[model samples]
Target chain A: MTAWQTKLTETFGDACKFETFRDNIRCDVRTERFLEVMKNLRAQGFDLLLDVTGIDYLHYPKAADRYGVVYSLVNTESGERAYIKVRLNDPDPAVPSVYSIWKGCDWMERETYDMFGIVFEGHPDLRRILMPEEFTSFPLRKDYPLRGRGERHNFPTVLRSDG
Target chain B: MPLAPAAQYPIDADETPDHEYLYTLNFGPQHPATHTTLRLILTLDGETIVKAVPDIGYLHSGFEKLGEDLDYNQYVTIVDRMNYISPICNEIAWHHSVEKLMGLELTPRCKYIRTIIAELARISDHLLCVGAAALDLGGITAFLYAFNMREKIYNIFERMAGQRFHPSYTRVGGLMFDVDDGWVSLIRTFIKDEFPKAHTDVARLLNRNKIFIDRTKGVGVLTKEEAINRSASGPVARASGVVRDVRKEEPYLAYKDLDFQVICGTGGDCASRYLVRMGEMNESAKIISQAVENIPSGPINIDVEDKLTVPDKSSTYRSIEGLIQHFELFMWNRRWKPPVNECYGATEAPNGELGFYLVSDGDGKAYRAKTRPPSFIHFSLFPHLIEGHAIGDVPAVLGSLNIIAAELDR
Candidate 1:
């Protein structure tokens, strides 16, 4: 294990599971314990949260995890990055929001929720961001049809009175 | 958090508050200064903005969803629309991520060529940002001066990639073609002769102008702490004195070898952001000149044996082997399949940190392709920065950030 991975594992104990890939460190944490780990990571100078995105593993037949939320964080001083990921099963894919830890994750969590239908428990404005508020479906899921479910045609046309 | 009148905030409730009411103002989904369809719902106490809430998603196109459907090679066309101002930067960034996923190292010549093109794209993107920002602040002369130079860069793009706007010129392993001698000379001329003169003209028109300075200075200040907290990047963060340039820190492509400076600003105002971008343009021109002079001569693409790169036209037309290689590359089933693990590859896009997070399920198509667009993060900082400022300063702030709507929505 690299020094950072060792530090993370030492800090978080069994909750931190490190996966190193191509000079990048990806630390997968237990869903319930991720918020605690994230707070500590924030205190440890992992200042900037780069992105928050969700991945559905329905198409990956061999994979055990059904849904995953990936948080890419960066140490602004060193430019070193790490990914904190949490896996969830079917029915309820929920994770604690990291908005309080890194304020940047507010919209990112909203975007993740908008696209993946992932319930962020403590997010202040937990609503659809990129998609319309009325839009029901999460278009980013692997099971979602590429051409869409004809939602574009469902809206009623509002023509101008003189037109 | 219910919408209320101004009287609620006053403790005494008798400080002449009954006559004053907070009214709502919508800046866009159609405002001219907002270069794209971005809606900002501002709670205004007369002219000064009390609070601001950005209502995005007006331009969401589901590009990430589209990326999952398209193959690694086929998705370059879709990525081009993310930042329309610097389409080649998007191409290079996408391909850079794709190549990282595939674990391919492009040739030395390919690196130099990409560095030159990417820097050109940066200059052009900054040119548009500076032009539009100045134009928004009623400086039409500077806008024309900047764009006149931008047209020459577009001409170079047209010559090199065959498209001025959405040049999907970058492939997974390398570029679509090599830069010819004439194209190189054109780029050299653009860097050496044209850019400095136009840059000076624009700078002279806006930099020290009293009206420009009065409107920009000490307005929409995003402090260094706030800049970091909001995860703002590129000139927005740099203007606030955040030393985070991906080209300087990460050094992808030929940037490590090339000589350039990551221009930063301490003022953190609209004027500072404008100055940072202007400084970056000069630095980009410097990098372009250095790269053009020292670009190594080698195969532009990875070797044909890799099967990830398209064969040259001469080879494809003259030899059956080259034809088969070309067919195999683009064929649906025969396209390259990467490992199942995921990797997040980022490039220092003109705006900021543009990253591509790709998850491959051991298939030709990516399982999940998430783009960390700089505009999205930068736009998130809008509400915080624009608060307590005059409504008219909205354009100045937004223009400085240079948020492309497509990128924000994507």
Candidate 2:
């Protein structure tokens, strides 16, 4: 185990499940302790928040959780990467925001909220970032069809002559 | 570094009496500074920018959603569209992720070829960014000089992959085709002669020019601590003296064998970014030259006996076994046997660290594919950089960040 992994597993016990794939040290944490775990990670030197994304595991073969929020963090000093994921259930999934730790998660959290309908509670601005304000459905969900649900056709067309 | 703010933003700390008079200026869906798509809501105190709200997603095409529908090989075409300036970077990064998920060890020859092409893509991307930044600041001669070499790069890629614009030349385990002696000479000719002349011309035109210096020297400064805290990478973060390059940090695709230095600058301004990119281009040329000379003479794709990749055209036409292998791989059922696991692989793309987070379910397509595009993260870092700068410095900062719209919103 890496230094942080040993520290976390000892303290949190069953809450932090460690898995290594390739070189990334992945730790899957339960949703409730996600924020606390992230805070600890921040203190442990995983300072660079490389990415924040969401995944819907509705029809997956091995998954027990319905939704997952992934945090791809990097320790700039050590050149190490850590992938921390938290399991959240289906209906209006919400997790505590990590904006307090890494200021970079502002857009990433908004994007997760935009694409998967997962909410980051206490996010300064949690509005839709990619899709239009009036657009309702979350597009990245597994149940959401590939061609979309006619939302593409709903926009009012404008001609160049109007200029 | 004189203008580097002590905090992330000092807009509230220096609350002057005229803070109430700050006016909002909508800076583009049409502004010349914002390329074609990026829009920023600049809350300006006369000319000084108090706060800049970058409005992206003007070119969102639901690429991650599209990744679900297309198979691993088929998604390269779409992936290339993300960072159009360095489309090959996207191709390599996507396939790198796929290769990692499958736990496939590429041949040494394939690794050398990928490194060469990847370095070429880096040069091409940096050239465009530098040239376009000059153009944005009205140095037409330097833009022409940079584009001249970029055309040579396009010709070389065209010769390599038979496509100029979006060469989807990368497969999961290998490249679309092998680089012949002629293609090798084209690159050798490029780095040794063509690239240097153009680079020198651009450097001479912009390096010590007073106008260029005045516009970019101290504008849009990102301090080292702020850059690291905000997860900035590539030339942007390196310019702030962060000294983190993914190629050096985590070596992949033959970078471990290559000799190249991570270029950095302490200024963290637009001018510093331009200089860092210039230094990186020279390093990229060094990488390509070395790899071209040492490219192992072997198969570019995985061995046909492994049934991991498609057979070559001549073999497929003549050999009966090749026909069956082709049919088994593409025509009938797909031959991908991936583990049901998740993997995140990243490349030191020219713009920054372009990474792909892939989750596999033993299916031909990915269950979820999330892209950590450099443009996305860097654009998020935009408001932080542009907070205390003037309205005129928007293009300088934005162009230095090199925010490819498709990549930003993907």
Candidate 3:
């Protein structure tokens, strides 16, 4: 973790805010500089894009940002991992897609978009993944009710006679 | 590794095929070779798969939404259903994330027990995959031999956790129940006798079988670069010569003490995937045997002063303080005072890296609980792997990928 932190501090000093949590490096990158920083990090040897998850901090006590898109990257060589977090304002939060860096993030980005309604700008195939194609609600959002809003009830029942 | 079987099985030159019209085929959604519910919308040129669009989400059960409502301990039930093949792995992964978030250190005994069970889960998961692959490729004998061994593992689980399939067996700081010597003996018996005999049986059955080799050898070849680019892990990536295993790379539980080689395959084909899983099952058995033999004697959970795990049954029944603690734990809840922070904890599950990214707001339940299921990422690799293969080769490739449908759509 220290190995990457020093290089990160030297390269993107003030641009990327660095912090440590539970033996891994976490950097807060601004939304505009997200793509550039990621491309640079890819060059820095974080080859594997482990995960892309979205967080809706609607009523969170700590975070000031409304939505958060977390990109977990790993350097398979040194076994080093770091998280690149880009915070965005609500009402159509968008972050540049890392699909250009790692083609594997395609489904992850789509899933994030499907859940948090956080659009991944420049994603190749951005669509709902875990939810139905016609689903209108972002189910994972804090505002979305747990039991659902009669979405399941509205589904056309296919009875035995109808079949 | 051989490329697609276009040379082996070509479009018949006898028929005058229309160039403009391509046959649209629905491979699955409900098919035996799919082994689960997932639809691959394939654009075909004769018998070859031109392109595949996997239509998933048939098993979306609002799992993440339910995570928001349930507390940390109660959410284990939902996690079990994520990768339902080896349900204990899901439980371990969920608790691993929660424990990391809450900064809890498990006891030595607990760590050893978890390591054994985790390896058991890995073995069980691989058996089902390998057995199903054999079954899909028309080798029922291997499948039967594999399931017989898997049933023994289930017996161990039933003895230890009281459930066979969906074992909600892990808690935040510890396990559901501590194992007795009888359970340890059962695990030892499986590891020593049942595992080796079954492994040998399946190896003998499929390793040299001409049909199995011909069907899987060159089918669905994935290069090391493509595997890395697609974020493939576990046996899938290892079979492609990507020497990355979360257990060896990031030592957790009792893995650091256990000695086992991270298996790698040179072929990067369906056959290599099968071989990698076969080699890994042996490694998992070795790990279990070592851990079971060197079992530690101590308490299973963290210190009671931490107030994380449930009190022992004896204390709960006998003592007044224990009853109140139980009452506070379930009824009042909201006892957690963890730091308002977030962490991503990953485990090298049987499939791949099963991780949980938890955001704690100093509350009982997670502010955000995002699961990083391996199958979801692996499913995306389908289009690339099955691009040029024949329709008949779909089962061989799919079985190698071992896409647990629920995990992919969860």
Candidate 4:
């Protein structure tokens, strides 16, 4: 095991479920320590924030959290990558912003906010990035209706080019 | 730091100042540079952009929400639509994520086929980028030349997969169907004949054109550190001399076996980025040529049990085992349930690093599926790059980013 893995195993032992897949160590950090783990990972040389996004898990039988915010980090020099997951309850899905550490997380975190309504506390400018501001509700949430209630009737008129 | 000329526009002393607060200029939901239905609400100070807050869900089709409703196998089609310009990348990324979770290894032949098709997709995507950049730079003829070539690549996709844009040709363990006979010969001919001519035309039309160079050179320069810090990948990062390629860094499919140079540019400007992509397209052509000639002869799919392999022709005509396995593979294949873990898999998408982070609950369906769309990140740097440049250069810079709204919104 590498130093980062050892440190990760020591810091969040048992609380952090560690597994290896495709040569990348995946650490499922406890929701509360998600930010701390990410901070530590960055200090330990995982400087690149490759991706930050969410997943909906409403259908799973024993799903502890209704949503998951997946953070993928990589050390550019060492080529060591880690996937750190933070699960959130459906009612109040939120996590601390990693944007402070990774500037790339700005848009990605906003995207998560846009799709799944997972708020990143302290995100520089958190807003709907891929949807109309007037639109109500997060579209990527599992319960969110794919086709709005009788909204098909509103399509022809509402869908006019915004020009 | 040279102040922009646009910043020099003087406020007239005689003109009556409106008492109204600074107005927010909604740039899109239909702006030409937005590429799709992206909307950016920019609070402006006269002509200077003050604060740019992007509002994006116009192109959202409830993909993640839809993922839950659809079966595992059926979801690949939806994934293909996420990045419409290079649907194959999306398809393969989704497939690899699920495959990783399931701990399934595809046959060598399947990997080679995937590599070939993926390179074709890259070529088509780069052609679109170069062509669109030229069009944005006011060279309509270059756009036509590039689009004509793109059409040929699309035709190849159509002939092979029977779909033009969103071909859900990739499956979890292998391809949805094997390549038809003589497809290799057709691809070989395309690589030898059509591909070079198109590239030559693109180069001749815009590569070093004075106006194009003046507009693109030294514009939107991202430093190597900034590119890495911003998690930029593919051509955008490569253009900045950051030698990070998912294929080269962490090999997948036949990338480990096949040989190709990792193209890089030290300039980190729009021109450098353009050249990098052009070079990459040529490299992709070479990879495809190599793949076609040396493709191994074997079953395209792994020798998995019937349940995980292929579906039966008709339920009424098939035996009970076939029906059971079909249901297992299609509807409820617990055997293919991924381990209770998470995996991040990225590919060299046309825009950048198209990665998929999957969380598996050791169940038939994915616990969570998160996509790391390159365009979304690349577009984040847009305001930063376009801030000080001339307004005329916005479209050229935007085109060079090669953002497909589907991926951006997804």
Chain B alone, TM-score, model 3: 0.94
Off by over 4 Å in 2: A155-163, B1-20, B331-333
TM-score of 3: 0.95
Q: If candidate 2 were superposed on the true structure by all CA atoms, what would the RMSD be? A: 5.9
Residue-wise C-alpha lDDT for candidate 1, range B1-410, written one tens digit per residue: 87898876665656756436788887889988887998988899889899898999988988988898889878999999999999889988888888888899999999999999899999999999999998999988888888888899889989998988787998878888888999999987888899999999888888899998988999989899888888888889999999999898888999999888989999999999999999999999999989899999989888888777888889899999999987876788777768778999999999998989999877888888999999999989888888888988988889988999999997
**Off by more than 4 A, model 1:** A155-162, B1-20
User: How large a fraction of the reference contact set does each model reproduce?
Assistant: 0.67, 0.77, 0.75, 0.84
- TM-score of the second chain, each candidate in turn, equals 0.94, 0.93, 0.94, 0.90
What overall lDDT, based on C-alpha atoms, would model 2 receive against the true structure?
0.88
The TM-score that candidate 2 achieves is: 0.95
* Ten-residue region with minimum lDDT total, candidate 1 chain A: A1-10
Candidate whose DockQ is highest? 3
Sum up the clashes in candidate 4: 5
Q: After superposition, how far is residue B359 of candidate 4 from its true place, in Å?
A: 3.3
Which residue ranges in model 3 land beyond 4 Å of their true spot? Answer: A156-163, B1-19
Query: Per-residue lDDT for A30-103 in model 3, tens only?
Result: 77778888888889898999899889999899668999888999988898899999999966688888888899
- Candidate 3's C-alpha lDDT? 0.88
RMSD of each: 3.6, 5.9, 5.0, 5.2
Which pairs clash (backbone N, Cα, C closer than 3 Å) in model 1?
none
